[model samples]
Target chain A: MGKYLPKAIVHSDEIDRLLAVEPGWTKKKSGVEKRHYAKSETASDMGAEAVKKALQNADTTLDEIDAIICTSGTMEQPIPCTASLIHKKLAPARPIPAFDINSTCLSFVTGFDLISHAVANGTYKKVVIVASEIASVGLNREQKESYVLFGDAAAACVVETADEETTGILAAKMETYSEGAHLTEIRGGGTKYHPNFHHNEQDFLFDMDGQKVFRMSSKVINPFVDELLQEADLSIKDLKAVVPHQASGMAMRLLQKKLGIPSSQFINVIENYGNTIAASIPLALCDAIESGKIQRGDHVMLLGTSAGLSLGGMIFVY
Target chain B: MGKYLPKAIVHSDEIDRLLAVEPGWTKKKSGVEKRHYAKSETASDMGAEAVKKALQNADTTLDEIDAIICTSGTMEQPIPCTASLIHKKLAPARPIPAFDINSTCLSFVTGFDLISHAVANGTYKKVVIVASEIASVGLNREQKESYVLFGDAAAACVVETADEETTGILAAKMETYSEGAHLTEIRGGGTKYHPNFHHNEQDFLFDMDGQKVFRMSSKVINPFVDELLQEADLSIKDLKAVVPHQASGMAMRLLQKKLGIPSSQFINVIENYGNTIAASIPLALCDAIESGKIQRGDHVMLLGTSAGLSLGGMIFVY
Candidate 1:
């Protein structure tokens, strides 16, 4: 992997409590500041903000973006997709392609992959990818095990042609494992238990088998990373930083050990951001880029694993 | 556009009505006598069922599938994607690559596009794309405009490479109109309007401006269809059927008038399905295949539009 597009970020502290949740009965872990939770944060608001910041960082404007692929909008509380919402919010003068990418926490990477392909294929010149999450609300807030494990955030990156170097997106792979879905799930909405206008209580809460999920993560995630590394033609020794999903301490530690990446090599933000799910990876990247953890021509890997039991990893050059 | 892959379908009619106020709505859909629905359906249940049907239709087990992409988990719900829910249901089997495809209702077309590309590119042979929607549960049963316009159902397609004469997918293009998002949306969910564990009535109900949506459909849908036809170098003269998003009679009729497509050439099932949204296209296709309304080697177009104010059209030669 080689060069990367520049990015920047801004966040709120209220959302961070959810990001810094300690595991059920365990001390907090990692470099994350605790996630940014919005008091009334919505995907569009966060996406707009992040896009503003990213464009500011790039010293560009919305008119310059060729396209924007956003991965946000949860069904838990149900609303119009963040992409559509953002599209509406966009200045009419800046009418570019924008749509929601719904691939779990891996959505950002998925957006990353799609934008890269679009750019690589020369279909679009400059693409914007945003990973925004407003997850703190759909939770069973009283459930200590899950409530604090999330925050609200939106992170964006602008990808464009560069003659200077070759450190952008190099290789990426996405997979889904339905067999372990029950390990973690928000049991209500959708076709099975379609929410009614009546809003039934007993049947509409998020449920999960924590142990089962931790086990599933242990079983498939990092192992998947190893496969991605092989595909990218790099190894743990080659990567400058590893930006993985922000789910929990249990899943994170197991992944770190399996990959043998040192604490520093791991771009950790979970301690402060708990699990922003789809928003975590890019949020971390935004923070890392700002903190000087990732620089031009550096090789990095972004991995994701979440609700669909989906796992994906990509090799990114800087 | 050249090769063929018949997307396998999984279907059932069990407990379809329990999800509806007019429990009989399931069987009343145009040309659709029965369909799959959860009694208290969750996205996972519908998605899982469709995956099972797809597995059975394709004569392949879970382990054999390379990927599964789907939609419809928004109850503002969180934890896992509807894709994960299906993956979890395919238990004790090896994990399959999976993710959700959501550009809103066009998810079917989007899912099809992804599967087709992977197969054509020789990266994967078996891919499952599912669109499960229990829209009925999200809107008020009393709102005849909303309730009478929705039916809870799911559709899955297991696609694979095939040399069989003319039985498969064709070319597709996806487009989004993020502008119309406000015309149709579930409105509450995510960090913005957290689902009150107490069953926020506002959170559960779907909000749509029927007249505006109709206006968009009337004004834009036909143009979208015409563009696809023109791209294919064909015309209304070339299509045996046009399966549109099952939204409403007014929209469909307006489309038929604008395109000058005879009522016969226009597929009708919205009255019964009540706009299954993403499920409408494939659901219509399933019935067409089984009922012989659309024969082998026939040309058909699948069109989708939903809350994202998103729009997409695909021309399939099946």
Candidate 2:
């Protein structure tokens, strides 16, 4: 493996929970039915699994990695980084480098940039990136609106250098938006609502202004796609499949419709996966790959948005 | 001022406390005593002051910067992003792109790569980067042992394509260690410890394995610096100064000794700045420049390390 190590995609939905909320709680609007919910475990486990898979998939060992780039929105622990915790699963003597990115959903894209540059610049020979989202853990089951829209899943991508043209990722573009940060934010524990006092509980809930997020989602969807198009020197006509972030089925459909494409032209995982948040983009893209929708030469457009109101886009050929 | 933006460096007394409990607390061998500390305020304010100085030193206006990259380890509010908060302080409208980097202390190096590549490959022309840290809010200030070693500080740099051979940044590198994420970290508040429970207030405090961190720190520092040194084709003898993360006076001195450089050859800011975390690297470099310790054609090595256990080193000549 070059910059990207071996990765394995794992999804969990085995946890049994009561689906009590909003309308159509049982109905999977975007094809998303049940998402993996961690009981006592954390997102790091999912990340760890992916890391393990990536290593096994690539026939490499954890000690071989120069560094591990962890991209996720669901931060599992505070002191020990989820990545570090995951790394702890291995030998402590093999203290490989690692860090986490909080660019919201843009994390993977940012992760790609970090890994790509590291490899490009020769700081690392092999690096691993794991994208895991435990959205189900943060959203209260009581909030059917948000609950039904999320799916918890993790995907691993192993990037390695090869003469194979299709193997190396071509180009990527990742950007962030702080003006719309509050559009989808978990307003707790951060400095904004932090408390030194012991009685101050209730700061860790995932709170969001859904309508605002929808509005922001609607606004950025096209311009970014256009920017990506211009940068890649490609067009809607050239893309074989567009993997927009799996947020709401309505959002994906709207973007697809606005782009004037058949529903088949878009990858729809929400119907079965709900919204995996950051994991949704990669999960859907990889799902498209697994389902044989993608070919070796087809250009794929991956766009995602996160709770930080962050937006990122990356294009690669499978 | 002609080719690069000017910045101010500030250090606090909170550094020793950090080094004291650093994973290898028994080592008690931090090379620097003071780091940097920020007063109770928004990261943007601290960053803004640095930005203002950079602007004044560069003799430019906010409108001149095509984009601003606000880098911070401690943000007042994680939502708006420290950069966006600074953007609100500037003219909100003029196409000035802003965002923050959480690569831990390697942030500036990461920012260096982003902008350098953006300007080199993308459409950005003039870009600025701000390194600001105010980690005190997360500490148990009651524990003077930890609080005294960290201080709040911010530094700014205007990066642009200039026709100068004397003072301009050259090659840069970035890498992360997910394993190192916990080297220095706060143990609570995200998905791991559902901060919604009021009794877990202590989880919000920074919990670090000092000995583990220092050991990891020394381990990663040399290799990282070597990467940059190789990339820049510079030997230790070719460099005029080494501006490292201001973890402590003892740490810096140790690094100097390890690097086989005289104490005078090292740029020391820990005594005044404390451990500004991500801000230390850039802040110290700026201080070296302001003090005239670094001059035209001098090769400077900027190294960063922190909580995510990430380490990055880049060599630049100015």
Candidate 3:
């Protein structure tokens, strides 16, 4: 696992000044002390950096990778999937399959779960799944709720056929309740509200009904996690770590309490990174791995709620 | 397989009038006699319609599907994958996994190939892969080359575990040569060229260097097809039908000639539908199946060169 955080660090104080709010208000409301912001870096650039780091960590080269999948919530461009651009930046010696698998903020979990099946079936020997998000680009400053809750970062993992029988995905599940799809969305930049149609600038920015998303997610997450754990015949106590999406500080606290997971076992990085969208889970995973909170042979559960109002979880042995 | 065309049927003469060209010039230039243009329909609306038709053809219901994957070059909105919206429209009784797999114009081929592995491995029993493209909404009127070369349409297929021993994907391959990524693209509507930056309307429109795309594609296609055939240990003569992307009339003709596929065995729909982006290949497959050119036991090859400068092919028993 690897990650790339943009160099420009914007502290909560800076956000408060930008939003014309009182000091400490940003952190009090959003729980984001500081977050990375991209000034000139593109999502692909950050993604490539993360990929390179992952390759180095694995002691492998691009030539050994069978596929590159970009699991991003937001794209760098509308055409030619972002994975292609990342591949272009690396300039791999051979042509490998590059594509995007998007399920909003849960994209990384979804990609990891799906690709594990392929890897287990011997369809691919090794693959790189990268999640890159440039949330700073679409923030609506006037909407403090979403504006202060986003950050720019990229995370990647090199997944290969497990050499050991125990080191693979045990169980994975995803369920979408589309009734909450409207709770979080960018209304323009697509055919339904294309820019050519003269939609206003506000239409292009990110908008989220945080309260509604929380209500919908709260109603379904407990049962969804139960189903996931039941599939693996495991309980919350068996997990070494729970790396949930850094959606929000309050949501994470509520989820941990609802699931009865010990605070020591739940990974939290929103204080420094905010919600980096799809990059949140993997980024937090990387932090947990580096901090020795998770190690090889540990049973880790990746869980998240995405913009689709989807609940995704994967229990795997690292 | 099933498809849905919008109610607005646009004839070449109408395009000629819009472009102030001589009568019949539109057909002479773009080889499209008539194409569908969406007036009030959304991509998900057309996609749900196609899904319904596919479900009816398969004699099944949404309740039987294990997953829904939207493979499109364009999106209906920028958040919550398009598959979620399609699922919302269907209003499935259960929460099945819904997501997107994108590789631009080759999205449907990528989705079909990837989902086949899941089905074969028993991860999913039945899956619906839908490609919906609204190209008309992004056409640049001043650039007659791409402006007249696109249409709006949706095509879908129901893929399930094959009951017969020989009915499965024989071989599939995808390779991306990002050197030609710039040959075709919509440079905006994403973080790199965000709407907040005040990029002009042209940035969000589709742009293609037809000559470059042709030249680059021609150099790699023959060998790519040979590799696909070699993997299956079969020659081109064994293929019952070659369903290629309806990229352009000229490009398709050249590809057929280069691959030495007979005219009768090649499925061509550009004359009626133009290029539907990601929907083109599946749309052509639907037409071929409807016309009885491809049958249940026949060997069919799906091949295309997409905006990623990617070559994708899958040989399977229909």
Candidate 4:
């Protein structure tokens, strides 16, 4: 796993000052100080960079990739899937099929689960899952609470089968509660509110009821994680580490406590990267590996709650 | 398979008069004389309706669905995957996973391929795939040529392994050529041209180089379909029917001539439905089955070319 962050770093304090928010608001509310924002770079461009770095980290070349799956919450274009653009820059000569899986913030894990099934069914060999988000582009500066919790970044991973049975995804679960679907949304750009229909400027920006999402996730996350562990016939203690979506520092803490995982066993990067949407999990995984929190032959769990009011968990052996 | 077309019917003649198009121009060019448009229904609403009809058509209940895969070229909301919204309307009490697979117009086939792989891998028991497109909302009146070729419709399919080995997907192939990615696109509402940044109304509407797409598809479709049949150890004669993406009547005729398939084997509903984007394939399939062109145990092929400059083919026993 590898991550590519934009060079133009914007501090939350700066935004707070501009919005006339109290000093230290973002840090205290979300544990985010500064985050990167793409300047003259699209999500696909960032994805291409992340994919290149991921290939290098994996010690592999583009031709080795059998397919490309772009799971980003934000896409560069509304026509061609972002994966196609990323592939053009990464492996233009290869005829590998590319598409997109979008489940908002949980897109990466959902994509990983799909890739795992495809690999198990012998449909693919080396699949590259790239999740690049340009959240800053849609951030509502007026909605300071949610805007300050987002950052632009990308992460990619080359996944393949392991030599041992102990490796690979052991158990996975995904569920969406659309009853809370309106909790977080971008009202425009989709069919419901087309730009041609003369929608308000705010309709085009990100809107969120952060408290509702948090409350709903709190009620579901614990039971969902426990059931997933039980179904896999493993206990939380057996996991070497848990790499969760870096949604917010407070959310991560709550998840850590709810899952009964020690603080040391949880990977948290929200303090720096903020909520990178679909890239959060893989980015956290990369952070865990680089910091030696996750090692070979260890059991690690990737979990997250997405904007769809969707919760997903996947346990795997590294 | 099932489709939900809005009650409101709009003929090309009406559009021609509205856009000051030459009388009979649309039918002469694309064979789209009349098509349905959603007067008030949204993509997700149409998708939900389609899913309900699909469930009834498949004689399955909501709880029987293991997952809901939304593969529409247009979505209802930007945050929650359309699958989640459809799932909310279809089975609010169920905890089944919901997500999206997007590859522009080819999303349905791409999603079907993924669902087939998942079912084969035992990750899912039954899946509901819904493709709903509200193309009417994004139609650029200025681009009268492509605009008049599209309609708003939704299609859904319930997929599971067949009771016998003679059924299910027999062979599938998907390939993308990124060089033609810009041939068809909606330049706004995405990261490349965020709605937050000022953009022209036309930028948010669909744009296409029809000639370029036709030339590219002509160069690739025949060879790709032939290779797919060869790899599957089957011939064109083995297929009882070929349900293709009803992009246009002329395009379908060209494909039939190029592939050497008889007109009787080809399924075209463009005259009534126009190009419903991702729903075109499944919608055509349902039309074929209902019209008795495709019968159970018959080998049927679903093939199409998408905006990614991608071509895909899947032969399956009906």
Candidate 5:
């Protein structure tokens, strides 16, 4: 596991200066003080940097990786999945399979769901999953309410088949509700609005209804997490940490309270990092591991809600 | 098992009038006579229509699908992963997981590889793999050589866990050479050159070095197909059909001659519809099945070279 954050920090106090509007209101509303922004870096570049760190932490070489699965919410280019470019940077000599799996912000969890199955089935030896986001470049200034909640960051994980003696994923599930797909989206840059056809700057950027996402997520997340634990034959008491997506400070607090997970056991990093889109859960898990909050043989829950009005949760052992 | 193509047809000869290039040059250069273009449809709209046909062919309903994995090279929107919108169109009442997996033109094979693994593991009961492309909208007339080769189309397949008594996938492999990642790309819509940063129409459209891609693909495709058969414990003699990606007329011809596959077994539709990117292989396979060229119990080879300078081959029973 490894994480990377760009150096350009923009505090909520600076939003007014940048957007020429009121500032402190964002922090007061979302609890995000400051967030990192990329300086001349593309999403794939950030992803490649994170992969190098992950390989080092795993004590593995790039060539040992059978596949590179990129789950980035924002891509470096529209063609040739970002994973290919990451593979070029990480292991140019190795002809490994590479592709992109996207479910917006929940992309990493979806990638994990697929990779875990492939690894467990003995179809792949090692797979590197990287979720990178350069949200600063796409943030809509007019939509400061949602813009202030996002930050630029990348996280990567090296997954391999776990032996019988080792603890591995016990249960995993992914579900989506398209009814809320429009709640978070970038309306342009695709076939629907090819630059030749519809050219609107704001349409090319991110938009979200934060309050609606919170209300919608609240309805299903508790049951989603509970069902995961039940399927894994475990209880919340056994969980050392529930590393939920670092979406928003308020959302995380509400989720933790609704699920009855202790603040000590709930991994939260939105204050310092903001919502790093797909990279959120992995980055939070890295923080938990480095801080010694989660130890080997401890049960941990990987959970999140995504743009597709999606809910996914996985119970696994560290 | 089913497919759908748009009604609007734009012929190659018409390209000269539309772009004011030259008459009969597109066909003489790329062997493309005509192609389809979506009139008022988005990529997801085309994909949902295809999914409906696939469901009917499979004698299944939209709600029966456990997952919708869209592998479209071109998307309807920049966010929400295209599949979610397609799900909304196809199964609004069902809350199934939907996402997109992209490897450019080879996206379908990649989706199939993942879906097969998940189905085999019983992680998903019924998954709909859709490869939809609206390349006509992205074609850059300034780059006529590559532009003339693209067409609009969509194809889909309904896959479930195969019973032990039924024949399913024998072997599958997907490999990429990111060294050629820049060979074929749409550079603008994403973070590297977001519409907000670089708003040039050409920057948002397709770019390609056809000769270089041909040289690069020629190096690996033969072995890619051969190894797939070898892993499946079969040979070219045992193959009933070879459905290659409908990239171009000359490229397909050269590939067939090199592989020693008879024209009787080789499937080609580039003349009528041009290259449809990710939709090519499945569309060709669907044609083969409908035409009775590939029958039940027959061993068919699905092979393609994608924009990532990628090569993928899947030998399975029809």
Candidate 6:
């Protein structure tokens, strides 16, 4: 696992000043103390850095990787999937398949779950899945609920056939309750509300009905986690670590409490990193692994609720 | 296989009139006689229609589908991936895993190839892959080269475990040469040139250097196809049908000639459909299957070069 954050780290104090709020208002409202914000770094640049770190951590080179899959919530450019741009930055010695799998904030979890099967089936010997987000770019400063809740970062993992029989995905599931699709969204920058045809700046910025998203997610998450754990024939107590998407401080707290997991078992990085969109889960997972909250041979669960109003979870032994 | 086109049908004559060009010039330059343009339809709307037709064709209902994957070059919205929106429109009886695999024009090819492995391995029993594009919305009408070269459409296919032993993918490969990534692109509609911060109208439009794309593709396609055939241990003569991305008339003619594939074996629908971005391959494939050009147990190859400057091919026994 690997991670990369841009050099510009903005503290909640900075956001408070920028938004002309009280000193602790930004942190209190968003539960973000400090987070990385990209000034000039591109998503692909951060992603490539993460990939390089991942390769180094795995003690492997790009030559050993069979495929590169980028799971990004927001793209750097609309054409040539973000993976290709990351590939361009990496400049691998040989050509390899590069593509993207997007599921909003749950992109990393979705990519990991799906690609793990491909790896186990011998379709690819080794693959690099990178989740990179420049969430700071699209924030609507007028909407404090979402504007200060996102950060810019990239995280990557090197996945391959498991060397140990027990160290593999035990169960993975994703369900989309599209009824909440409108709860969280960037309505512009696509065909439906294209920039060329529409000039509303607000549409291009990130917009979210935080209350609706919370309400929708609260209703679905419990049962979704139950289904995931049931599929693996395990209980929440069996997990050594639970890496959930750093969606927000309230969501994480509520989810952890609802799941009845101890604070030590639930990974939380939002206070420092904010919500990095698709990079949240993998970034938090990396932190867990690096901090020894999760270790080899330990059972872990990765879970998240994405903008699709989708619930995704994967149980596996690390 | 299934397909959907919007209510509006646009002929080259209309384009000529709009561009103040001589009659027949649009068709002569673009090799596109007429194409469908969306008036009020959305990508997800068309994608749901295609998914419905695909389900009917497969004699299955949404309840039987284990997953939904949307492969589109352009998205309906920037958040909550298009697959989720399609799922919303379909309103399946139950929640299913829905996401997106994007590789620009080769999105369907990539999704089909990758998801085939998942199906064969029993990760999913049945999956629907939909490729929908609203290329007309992003066209730069002032740039006639690409202005009349695109249309809006959607196509989908139902994939599941093959009952016949011979009906399956034999081999598949994709290689990205990102050096050509800049040759074709929609530079805006994403984080790098976001509409909120950047107001250049030209940046949001589809931009392409046809000559550069051709030069890049021509240099890599022959060897790429050779490698694909070698991997499958089959020669060009063995393929009963060749379904290539209806990128453009010139590209199709050049690739077919370079590949030494006979016209009878080549699938061409660009003249009638124009270049439907990611939907081109599946739309053409559906036409081929419906028109009896490709039959059961036939050895067929699906190939395309996408905006990533990526070459992809899959040889399978249909």
Estimate TM-scores for all models.
0.82, 0.83, 0.99, 0.98, 0.98, 0.98
lDDT: worst 10-residue window of model 1 chain B: B1-10
lDDT of 1 by residue, A1-318 (tens): 111121322232332454454333323332334455555545676777787788888888877777667775353225555666766666433435455667667888876765565565455778777777666556664555565466667778888877765766667887666666666666555434444433554334555566776777677666687788887888888888998887777677777888788988998777756677677888888888888998988899988676666777889887
Candidate 6 docking classification: medium
On DockQ, the leading prediction is 5
What is the CA-based DockQ of model 2?
0.33
User: What does candidate 6's lDDT look like per residue over A69-177, in tens digits?
Assistant: 9999999999868999999888644688899999999999998988887788898999999998999989998998788899999999999987769698989989988
Model 3 over residues B1-318: C-alpha lDDT tens digits? Answer: 889999999999999999998998888778889999988899999999999999998899898899999999999999979999898898645688899999999999999988887788888999899999899989998889888889999999999976768688888999999888777899998999987785688888888899998888788888899999999888989999999999878788889999999998899999999999999999999999999999988999999999878999999898
Q: Estimate, for each residue in A1-318, the C-alpha lDDT of model 2 and write its tens digit.
A: 111111232222322235533444345443455555555456776777767776785788876777666667666654444566666554355656555555666666666654665565455667787777766556655555565566667766666555455554555655445566555656555544554642334334455667787777677667777887887888887888888788787777776787786767688877666676656676777678768887768888777766545567777766
Clashes of each: 52, 77, 0, 0, 0, 0
What pairs collide in candidate 4?
none
lDDT of 3 by residue, A266-298 (tens): 999999999999999999999998889999999
Error of 2 at A59 (Å): 6.0
Instruction: Point out where model 3 deviates above 4 Å.
Output: none
lDDT of 5 by residue, A60-116 (tens): 988788999999878888987899888888777778998999988889989888878
What is the lDDT for A69 in model 3? 95
lDDT of 5: 0.87
Tens digits of per-residue lDDT, candidate 2, B23-74, equal 4342244333434334445566667778888888778887777766765655
- TM-score of predicted chain B, candidate 1: 0.82
* lDDT on C-alpha atoms for all candidate structures: 0.64, 0.63, 0.91, 0.87, 0.87, 0.90
In model 2, the Cα lDDT at residue B92 comes to 48
Q: For residue B52, give model 6's deviation from the true position in Å.
A: 0.8
